[model samples]
Target: MRIAVPLPGTMWAFDVISIIQIFDDDSVMYGSSDRPVIDFIANASSKALDHGMSIATTALRDYHEKPDLIIIPGFANPHEIATDRRTRDAKARLFTADPADALAIRDWLVASHREGVEIAAMCTGMFALAWTGLLDGVECTTHLPFLDDLAAQFPKALVQKDRLLTHNAKQRIWTSAGGSICLDLCIALLAEHAGQSLATAEANMLMMHYPRSVATRRSDGAPSVLPRPSRQSDEIIALTRRVREHLSYDWTLTTLAQTSHSSTRSFQRRFSEVMGVPPSTWLLTERLNAAKELLELTDLPMQQIALRTGLRNADSLRKHFSAAFGVSPSRYRQDFLRTELRPTENV
Candidate 1:
């Protein structure tokens, strides 16, 4: 399948490459060694940036071969530019007024959809796609910080507040949240086009645990673990301890209630009363917290950690991680490791 990626000044580079790599893998089920081909083209009007940075053109005109997918990567903000006023102003003009890039992308997206092509956006690229009006009435997600802005700007679109990826089958438009979640979306796409095994292999090659579905929520407003009054509350704590001890076990409300010597209704009530959330919600959070600790201190593969933490599988763990931290397991580990190794500033 051919995928077209339009480049705008300040587009985040990693977002573009993550999508490209999945389709480029020749060993995958969807890929063919003989005819495995994926194409990327930068659709920008001028190849030269006024700031002295040069961008190459894969195609001079926007109309080339129709791509099966078109992508727009997130852009750098105005505040991030350190160049002179002229360069900054030029960038602003290019982005706001130069409809060449946007129009070309819009035409390709509309045409591709008419011919059964898929259009996707990563991070803030959702803004550009939303501008095309194709995402109207479609469910989509963008970077969390921009959720409010995207909703307000495009009231016609259904903006999902807490999702790693959201899609509207009607529009065939897919959007993903933040940077690392872009990789998750690509893996999911690979799974759909190829098969579960190929997706798992691709994830293993990248050292990424397969990502979870985007519907998971990080918070259920649970209470802290400190002591609370009452005999029932203490029993709830004991049940929590048992849950933690056997995280790999399939825990059900009846199982927990039986272990705690309480009815399901009583267990649910007391657990929620003491923890400020349902028992199941508390258990999931505990598992996720334990997984985070293991990720921080140990170099265990995500699948092992998931098994140890009682998550259903690696994909489920990634879903929780993405929802809780907005990053994949590997990226979170690297980031934590970097912070841990950083030299301490003298206080």
Candidate 2:
């Protein structure tokens, strides 16, 4: 697989380097025996650093050999970096005065997509993907802080704030939250090309526990809780934790209310008010979360996973998974498993 990485001034160095290392390690551990050769190109118009001391890349020409995959790393601060005059001037010479580097990267992205090349962005790199119009009508994610901005910037894009990664099949765009998660995303791609064992080995070499499948959602509909700010808040949080701990068993709101020694109605209202969701909603979300983890990390079948997660059957599990995420439980597993197979393929 041919991979292109276009660096830009102010680019987060670690994002690009980590991806390169992940692919390299995969090749040594898995490809040395049977995988395809993974070709990489650090394509750029000129090598420079932005004021923020981030590395910048040169532009990729239209006639340049198209890569099988392209990765765009995040910048130190995408908002400020995008507005830098030198960065704008350099990109303009490559792309068209004051042309946004995001647009330049988008052109190559679109071209690569047309050729069936996979395109991925890490962290705030989703910002650039959004600018390209390629992510229009596609589900994608970025750093949590930018979720609202991303939605506002590209209304057509389904910005999933509560996800570590999101893939838009219709547009062939994949995005993941920035920072160390980029390593997880790259490992996922390697897994898709190779196999799960190889992906796990590579992750182990990096001292990382292979992430739960990339298909896992950040929100399983659980209430987002803040640390208890006072004694009353702490008591509520303690109750919430207890409920979460018992998710795999049959527990009811009345049961929880009784435990907390409050009237059921008052307890329900208090739980909703403190946790930002009702107790039942929170319990179901916790169960679904447990199910999701098992689905991604284990080879267990749907029936077993459902039973272990406290769901009655596969049908019940699917209802919750589909309602929480737009995809079925089985489909999520397949998507995640496919990524694991990448590094094992004849690279």
Task: Name the candidate that leads on TM-score.
Answer: 2
Residue 115 error, candidate 1, Å: 2.2
For residue 129, model 2's alpha carbon misses the true position, in angstroms, by 1.1
Q: lDDT by residue for model 2 over 27-96, one digit each (tens)?
A: 4554344233333333454443334343434345533665667777775666653343443234333322
Give candidate 1 regions above 4 Å deviation. Answer: 25-36, 44-57, 60-63, 78-97, 218-347
Q: What is the C-alpha RMSD of each candidate to the true structure, in Å?
A: 13.9, 7.4
lDDT of 2: 0.65
Across residues 1-347, which tens digit of lDDT does each residue of candidate 1 receive? 45667665556656766766775665553433212234445554434333345445565264467665676667555233222234322433444346465566566566677898787788877766776677788888887778877787678989888666875555667788866778878876664343334566677687653243344332433333444577877677667767767988988888888988889988787766666567776677667767876786689999999999888789999998777545788887886667556553321
- C-alpha TM-scores of all predictions: 0.56, 0.56
With a 3 Å backbone cut-off (N, CA, C), the pairs that clash in candidate 1 are: none
Q: Which ten residues in a row have the lowest lDDT in candidate 1?
A: 80-89
How far in Å is the alpha carbon of 170 misplaced in model 1?
A: 2.9
